[model samples]
Target chain A: MHNRSGLLEACLLILLKENKSYGYNLMNDLHKFGFEEDSLNISVIYRNLRSMEKRGLITSSWAESDQGPRKRVYEITADGEQDLKNWIWMLKNRKSQIETIIEKYENLK
Target chain B: MHNRSGLLEACLLILLKENKSYGYNLMNDLHKFGFEEDSLNISVIYRNLRSMEKRGLITSSWAESDQGPRKRVYEITADGEQDLKNWIWMLKNRKSQIETIIEKYENLK
Candidate 1:
């Protein structure tokens, strides 16, 4: 699979910014946001969360869950908010470029 | 750098569909089409051409040039045209998805 880890990271930032969340719930939220279960798994989400934490984009803390085990909850840092803004800018720029290419392809026909 | 090789291949197919072209000229055409020269180089063009040929998406033939060494010109095969269509479809789908994500982000603000 061509990993869309960049897009995944962007989505993660968006979710964390709204409210601090743990892994399992975040995965569910991703599905609600249009990510298919097959397209992403818990491992990928965890890896990205860890990477983002290392990059200072987010921070994590363990919280006691009412059930089974303690959960690691993630929250967006100030850096994460800035990165999300950058991602939005880049995505908008790329959308315009793709639009141009699509227009060119249509005109050729 | 994140390799946008897939997008590069789509652009190459579009150019080939218009008319057969060699690597150097194709690079220039890409620049005119909004791909920055720094974003793509001759080697990347040649690499994609070769890979596309391997996949039967394009075919190449050496043509003698009066001013320089013989150049390999590339043309889109029937499969290349089909692949180009697929690429456009995928790009359109991705554009919509990106738009959805952007909208979600804006709504959160």
Candidate 2:
């Protein structure tokens, strides 16, 4: 399942902004962020990429890969960069929420 | 919308574990953890509460309130407490995922 926290978009945005990459590479990279097989699916990432592209947050182009067929390479647009920044701010802003839950747990114990 | 991270159940579990509380109070307490007007809905909380109860994670009792009509007070069951612990561990484990995103953001600047 796709991460429902709505932060997956931010993750994709940040990844694309940092270095333009193909969908497969992007999907692989998402694993580091707790988007494992159980929680994430490649199709979901693709759908989100399409959705982001439609929203103009990202753009894609056909590019030849060394090992295989041509792939669609995604890059973050200026709008995507700004949206990424906002997402980071929001995540950092809400860091305390998770921390608060942790704190409550500690107190309970 | 309810928090889709699946941590909302943990939050509710923690609250009930700490002290048995009625629905309204539990809803209000959720705000401290980022469950606000935009992201959290009362109906969703109730649904989750019912789901948890059905799952044998929590139990509820009706109590007379001086302020008003009888209210259903919820308390965490043994299974619920264990579930809360598991959730805490999972959140802590995934905390780095968020930090990784933040780190990537910093590197981009």
Candidate 3:
């Protein structure tokens, strides 16, 4: 029931690859990519982070932040990079299928 | 876990809208739309058909076919048309988000 498109995980990996980011900053970045705040909850982000770390796709380090509490900054691993590539392929595949359906529907209209 | 993109449902609705179809013919049409036979199981199609009928999105009638066994031909209902529109909107929304992520990654590379 969570992100059937798997966009959230892809975005997280891409953002981590772009730069090491903490959960709070990642949450903010998600908004920039069109994710709703309700859908991109803090707990959901944390859960995915933990799962990704467990999968050896990402690593995190606790760092002291000047304005707030210590933050866990995450960085994508080599495995994570490869996984992102696979996800990209899957997304492209799904996109094509969707486009085909849309085309069929438009023709019907 | 089934069709996170909801493409299957959308395709079925669109096909039904185009013409009333029996389950067997629908399976063949799916191949034309890029769905692999292995991925598009007959059972999966029936399950969706039953679910849609239960939801009042489609209606089916048993018919006698001269060439083979009796088949239940399905046609989209009024509610189904509305639902297809909603699915189209959702698909477009998800597509935009995926494109943004792909763009960001390409820029990173």
Residue B8's lDDT within candidate 1 is 76
Reference-based lDDT, residue B95, model 1: 80
Model 1 misses residue B105 by how many Å? 1.6
Pairs with backbone N, CA or C atoms under 3 Å apart (clashes), candidate 3: none
Per-residue lDDT of B1-109 in model 2, one digit per residue for the tens?
3335656887898888878897888889888777666677789788899999998998899999899889998888889988889889877756667788888789878
In terms of lDDT, the poorest run of 10 residues in model 3 chain B is: B1-10
- Give each model's clash number: 0, 0, 0
TM-score to native of every candidate shown = 0.88, 0.90, 0.88
Q: What is the DockQ of candidate 2?
A: 0.64
**Candidate 1 C-alpha lDDT tens digits along B14-61:** 888899998988888887566655766688678879988999999989
Candidate 2 per-residue C-alpha lDDT over A18-68 given as tens digits, one digit per residue, 9 for 90 to 100: 789978898888876666676777887889999989989999999987898
- DockQ numbers for every candidate? 0.52, 0.64, 0.65
Please state the error at residue B91 of candidate 3 in Å.
1.3
> Which ranges in model 1 have alpha carbons more than 4 Å from their true place?
A1-5, B1-5
